[model samples]
Target: MPTFNVKLPMILSLLLIFLALYVLALRGHFSYVAMRAGNYRFSKIESFNSLALNPLMSFSFALRDYQKDTLDLKPANMERLEELSKIFPLFSTTPKNDFALKNPPHIMVNLMESFGTQMLSLQEGNLNLLGELAQHFEEDFVWTRFLPCQNGTASSFFCLFFQSPIVLSKSKYKEHYLPFIPIEVYKQQGYRVIFLTAGNSTWSDLGFFMKAQGADEIIDEVALLQDYPNSSKIHFHSHYGVGDEFMYQKALELLSSAKEPLLILTLSVSNHPPYPEVPILFSKEQIPLEIFDKIPKNTSAILNTYVYANNEFARFLSKVKQSELKDKLIIAATGDHRVRGVAMDFNTEKALAYGVPFYLYVPKAYQGEIVYDKTRIGSHKDIFPTLYALTLSETRFLHLGGRNLLETQENDKFAFGFNAEVWIDNEGIYPRSSNLGYKYKDNQSLLSTEESFALDEEHLEFHKIYQEFLELQLRYKLLNLAQ
Candidate 1:
């Protein structure tokens, strides 16, 4: 009996140890699958970087059919990837980069829970980066604005025409906006839409999604890559997307010729890295060319390229403004998320890094001076509705989780911030301790209350919605789902 008792504990412990090892091995096999799980675990928490290390994307060369659709699996060697799977679960994206810009880098980080500007909690001050970037890109047109919510890019695009917040499956209650389709409105209002990217139409399956959202045309790299292969191999570099400037310049040509009152959302492929170095266009230097030349060709090149692109794009935009096309152009822009795995140089904090920047530039609405509150805040999802308010468009939105960028918001708070997610704003850092909770002020913070029951309830609903959205994303065959 005594021996059995002693052995029991040892046996039980051994069993547990064996079970743990087994589970770990299983996780090793399906680490990427686990990442898509959306649960709260150490794996889920730190997996953001690992995911960034390798972004699995579906990109196609323009007009190059017959080539099987391939996922851009970075850290490409399977054996090495398997080895990495043991050490650190990493994600791989297609492409890489090396380049820099004298003008400040027009960098955008599209992290789910990462925020920039150093602060960890949500506050007005944190989101000021968008406006700051806008100012940096300032030239002949207006630059600088703000919005609300980091909800997916879905609502961010639509809310551009209204003052409402567009919600994503990942958005908070007061934050989510109605997911109203706006293409009909734009078309009815006499606007031609073109959603451009460097991937096959089926990747985002954007042909259907954009048409549903009011896009009239789709210009992907598959169509434009052949136009400029010899021009420059340099790409701005983002983890996902193609490393093609042909698409960017091609889109520019199309926009340049557009009549007027045009709404364009140009999704570029260079800034996020996993890209080839592209050449700079500007003749002048705002930042420093040496920095550009020294960038690691792997991904840092995009850092340099993004800024240069931003500078040149800003210049191009200025010329676009000057063109006979139209005078009432308002560009609503923001990063989808943050850089995937910025560990060393930049502030890639889970909270800060997950947070991307946004701002508005309306040449017609140039009456307002550059509003750098250093105290105001907002998110990606809120962009669409925020802009809609300016245009006074009749389009209604649903499922958005952001608010107007131009107005003073009361109780500006967020709930259910996902992994490494930031909960901050300009007033100060509003921290949330749980997936669901009231806005966390500096004192108690939602971050601190994350373990609370209320937060759990929030998480439950949020997760439920997320799961439903995931199912829909899969069912609908949506590629990125925008969140």
Candidate 2:
């Protein structure tokens, strides 16, 4: 190749322009990702603008006030909401019955082992992707934000499936379906549903809650390993026992026997932890235990396992292409939650503890690829509702608590709270406060009042509605709320 003459001035000009643009983009990215969230808006636009510059401080302040919101609840409502929030895992509501259905448009994700970092890995030219890029997804799948439920894998899994937040804070291996999840409502409309965790059904007390919410059939490691007697491989890890991968292969088989439009979920355990003796991708020998042992205490093991899980996601994505159900499968791949012990040092301006990443990938229908946007505000709570909105028709789904991810707005607005965080982008609001801007896409003024009383009142009402949602969920046992 012949070298072209390069002018010093031209090179300098290009460099300057590139530098400027990069700086601008970085500023925008950081700003959007760092917005403050809590029970109350900022004292003033000036306060928010000043602190918002430092996202870490803003998020800390926000978290500090989470207890404040609960405290602010009227004694009666607080008691009512608390009672409704506890007991069954089905934790929320909106009064509507028999929501419409799109037949098999319901979704199920089989997390055959995943790590939070994989979603952030694109540095190696898609070499780490589980599946080849969905051509349409490459251009259109714009990432909106992070979802809140990243503490555990199961939390992220069920949260998105139900289109609402899964109450992991209650410290049980189980959670319930809130009425806000369109998928549960679809089941009310006569759709078939089943959740299969290839590990212990008791993983996280999920077995009890999964049933409370009305999963017709539930199978844990015992069933696959000895109880029901199906072919499965044994895997023994502190966190995940045998039959993790077995669940994947068997879930696929179940799909083969399923009627049209059925929703079947199969989760994995190998990537969960204590990963021992799994084969390396290219190495001939098995992964030596020493490598894992040599990791620097907690971080080293988590990192190694996370890397292994990332590769698994890439493998799963790639494997789907080679299968028959590619078209019918709308896989919502994401982390249940970032392993907090591993992410102990992580902090963000917009809810630092919420490092869980939720990515909704529909093989053929996905309009773009690389759904991760480093600067968007998102949470685990956003996963389920968005997943439902994406799979089913938008009109029917629009009413749900979670917004359609395809419509990720630009205003940097997220509905974030203890177990809930939802964002909608692309809207204009006066620089000062959160208006009704969130209640509806166009109704910015609906919430725009300088009055603290109305803010308090509306907030309480919203809280009440959310409580009612969970209460209804418990009553109906929708989305496995039975426990």
Candidate 3:
């Protein structure tokens, strides 16, 4: 009994001392920053180096926008720090750099929800929906691997627009106008922005987030019904509003009437769960026989539905070829996330599930000027930047971890998901996370890595910093919105 009392006091005292030291260290770091202009110059590379080594500096990296010289804590930032304390005990605020395009083109981004990369086959013998889309391309398109930040439609907004990791929590409601999002920049360039979603934009606070992205007109499920009272007959309906076919038709309509230099964001709903038995736009005759052979026997409803959506998408593209906007528009297609249906035994199916496919369709006019490689490895975070680079000449994005694909970089490309991450380069796909990890030298020699092992520890450390920066950036934006 006496030993317990004595040890209890000693333990308490030791904890108090440790706490005191931690507080002192924090104060010293802040004070040092205040005393100097910058302890270290803020280059993306230099910041990454410091972030990997110093936790405190990394925390600062989250709070302080390196683009801003002053580090004074604003009221909005204070609120952000308080809220962020739950996740990051010592997080703060900062600004980031912004990039601008000289002359942006008519941009149309088609986000296919619940679509997987495996749905599209690049192999010559394979019959696939992607093959049909590739038929439209005359060596002007780039087929590459892309990773979504998370496996949800809402998180994809941040992935594509903010060029960062998904928010840590799903319930985060507030949306901020971050400089990284292309909306404001596009607006400045006199581009008329339109957002069309075939589903309820409110499904994932997507409507709210899209508005924050500066959409001049957000045509959602409600809007679709109101616009076309006979939408039921004209459009297929499931859990969402109109189907992919109707959405594409609407997109084409908008494109035809759209003023010069327009930006349209289309999020399709046909690929979501409770997959349709029939294709929305395509007849059986229109679908190639090879696509049917690719389907496995006794396939799950989800897989069947996915194939249907893929066919419908191809049909839409076929119609687009006949439209005036074919050469007038630069189309970029990607999935919101991988298909989360029942697993299949096909090669690369698992890898494709986690990392969605990304394709860029360059108009024939600018095809020569635009740069892309079939070996390109990127994440959805790179989407906006890549699109910007293609449309605008020789430009860079600020506060984005992703580089313009046309530019060369020494760092390996990686795609981070909710619980897993994939490293993609010339080495092929290397699953780096402890969970759902795989090691592969080539497509033929793939092996699962031990789940207990942490693959690419140094690289993971860098990713951690990047994620923290995104979280902090998000928190700051939300808090700023609240104020």
Candidate 1 C-alpha lDDT tens digits along 1-483: 355446678989999999998666444333112422121111212354244322221122222322433322122234543443342222211111111111111111111112222221212332222222354344322211222233343343223322222232221222222233444434544656666654333333333345444566765543554455443233332234345345546655775655544555555545543444555432234324443343323333434444444544455455545564334455554554444433322212324434544545555333232333323444454454445444533335332344444543333433122222344443222223335333322322212222222344533344344333323322122222223
Q: Regarding TM-score, does 2 or 3 come out ahead?
A: 3
Root-mean-square deviation of every model:
19.8, 23.0, 19.0
Arrange candidates, best TM-score first. Answer: 3, 2, 1
Cα lDDT tens digits, model 3, 1-483, are: 455446888999999999998765554333112311123321224344244335675466445533433423232355544554544333211212132243346788888887766555423443344534556544345444557766677667556655434432223233445554677756766888888877766455565567766778777755565565555553366655566766776777887887668888888887775554444333455455554465433234544466666666677677766777677678888777766543444344435546676666666664443355655656666676666655654333343355556544433433222223544443434444423234442433222222223346644454555565556665555455557
TM-score of 2: 0.53
What are the per-residue Cα lDDT tens digits for candidate 2 across 309-412? 55544455556556766656666655555444332221111222333444454655432222334344444445555555445433343222343344434323
What's model 3's overall lDDT?
0.55
In TM-score terms, which candidate is top? 3
What clash count does candidate 3 reach?
7
lDDT of each: 0.38, 0.44, 0.55
Give stretches of model 2 more than 4 Å off.
1-103, 110-114, 118-144, 150-183, 226-239, 280-295, 298-300, 341-343, 346-353, 363-375, 394-401, 408-483
Worst 10 residues of 3 by lDDT: 91-100
Cα deviation at 215, candidate 1, in Å, is: 2.5
